[model samples]
Target: MNQVLTQKPHDMLAATLSNEMAAVNTLIQTRMASEHAPRIPEVTAHLVEAGGKRLRPMLTLATARLCGYSGDNHVKLAATVEFIHTATLLHDDVVDESGQRRGRPTANLLWDNKSSVLVGDYLFARSFQLMVETGSLRVLDILANASATIAEGEVLQMTAASDLATDEAIYLQVVRGKTAALFSAATQAGGVIAGAPETQVDALFAYGDALGVAFQIADDLLDYQGDSTATGKNVGDDFRERKLTLPVIKAVAQATAEERAFWMRTIEKGRQDEGDLNHALALMDKYDTLSATRRDAMEWVTKAQDALTALPNDPIRQMLHDLADYVVARLA
Candidate 1:
């Protein structure tokens, strides 16, 4: 299997998994509807139709097919993965007070916070219903635990967001809880549905976990370096938001007393003014925190690629391998 570094990784996966993805899409539409409330579908469609990459669900379909799964259950599982992801986005927008998502108005902004929160809950319930239809307790356990971990991670971030005391370890804990939990569960449940060997299933979980970490690190790094037109975000959005991501965490660890005061004034007290973003970038550059963050992201990418060696050597596996690299490649 030749590794493809030229193409978009998920696009390649989508081409290969087109049929399965269609089924997942149909299932998502069917399950997202509420007969009593037209408002439910309207709110759900606003976000669902917003053109976000369906990466999480695609991982489930890819892993299941890679493991030679032939059952229709993977379709249900893929939709379940999507529902969980959509639900999270709804709640996160409300929590983050985000006005925009994927370059469009967020559901909370379009409708209301109450609509966003309740629709998120509705999707969550739909997810469980879809998962239960699979009749695999192990699958249910993985997805259920992932849901809990994501909620816990969000809570942890709330406490750790502005605190300078947040170290890389705590940051990783939050990432694992909020992001990697679903990624791991998506791949793990896919393998479980295929009845793959225990080792392969564990490997799938590990791959998803590492990939999720790298994916998030790259996203945080982008907040500092990405083109606003391309990312649909201004540079240092996270800084203005006062979220203590890895680059800032690294910079804080190496901050001088004067630099510490700057971080405290801007990040801790939320008293940012003109030139603060530039100063934050300067300090991060002085400590080489962006490079340090990139290094950590690449390490996770390596971990993700290494995990793939445990699975069958095939086209899907190769695509997964490239997907790991492509995640961090955005930083370059």
Candidate 2:
């Protein structure tokens, strides 16, 4: 009701997501606490309170609740999802050398990478404990595969950076591996715990994968299009890092000999000057890469909604459908 789902002033998708996420806040809190280690609470609380949309865990719980699941495992599953997400954030800061997150100085910036990495390890271990408590090997397998895929994706992103030869196919693989894998696992596990029919379970997985891919692509597009105050990151931070995103990748695919020389000198070599950013963006516009990337993102959102057609016509399902549209529509 408060419309706090997004930091964006006009974004309704984030608002819808916020409403669903608000329902799971209590579960997130109760499970973030630890009895055995006093340090666990302080470290975990510091990061949890740092603020996130809690989208992953919210999907887990919302999907489970939508399926008429009456069991309490949704609580643990949701918490487990958050822990995994937080762990990734912590490690991501270390890897990216990022000093800020959620518009605040990051954990690594505040306490140093050592603390961030160690605390992240603790959360990973704790998440495993929560999953084990569920006594569901099937759940374990899903999360375990996600963890491996996440690690692999991170490494792949690192390797892909500054590679002028990177193509759109590899870019999509990186997105799926790094971003969508966990989302799919989170939603799929929700249906699994609900013991939903196999068809519905598969649908949830497809729904999440498409939504996550669209979400990441939208975020990438926003880097070139969004207001700096709203996104909480500097415009073109990806460009600053010489990272190849969808727009840049698409632009590269169509670059002429002269345009390729500019990209190789700037994005690939990190030889940026003041006007170089505008020049890079000009190339993206020249090749219609921004529009193309946005089209791809919308297609994924459509696919995500199609996956949800199997869900019953309920308020919750409608909310998810609207949320998918909202994720990509923000850029428009």
Among all candidates shown, the one with the greatest TM-score: 1
> Model 1 compared with the native: what TM-score?
0.98
Listed in order, each prediction's TM-score against the native is 0.98, 0.91
What does candidate 1's lDDT look like per residue over 190-280, in tens digits? 9999999999999999999999999999999999999887788778989999999999999999998999999999999999999999999
Q: Report the lDDT tens digits of candidate 2 across residue range 1-332.
A: 12324433223333544644554566556666677756556766777887777778878877887787888787788888888998899899999999778777888877788878887898898789888988889889999998998898889889997898888888888898778999999999998899888889999999999999999999999988887788888899999989999999999888899999999998888898999899988999888889999999999999999999997677678777877877876787
- Residue pairs with colliding backbones in model 2 are none
Off by over 4 Å in 1: 1-5
Ten residues in sequence with the least summed lDDT for candidate 2 = 1-10
> What CA root-mean-square deviation does each model show from the true structure?
1.3, 3.4
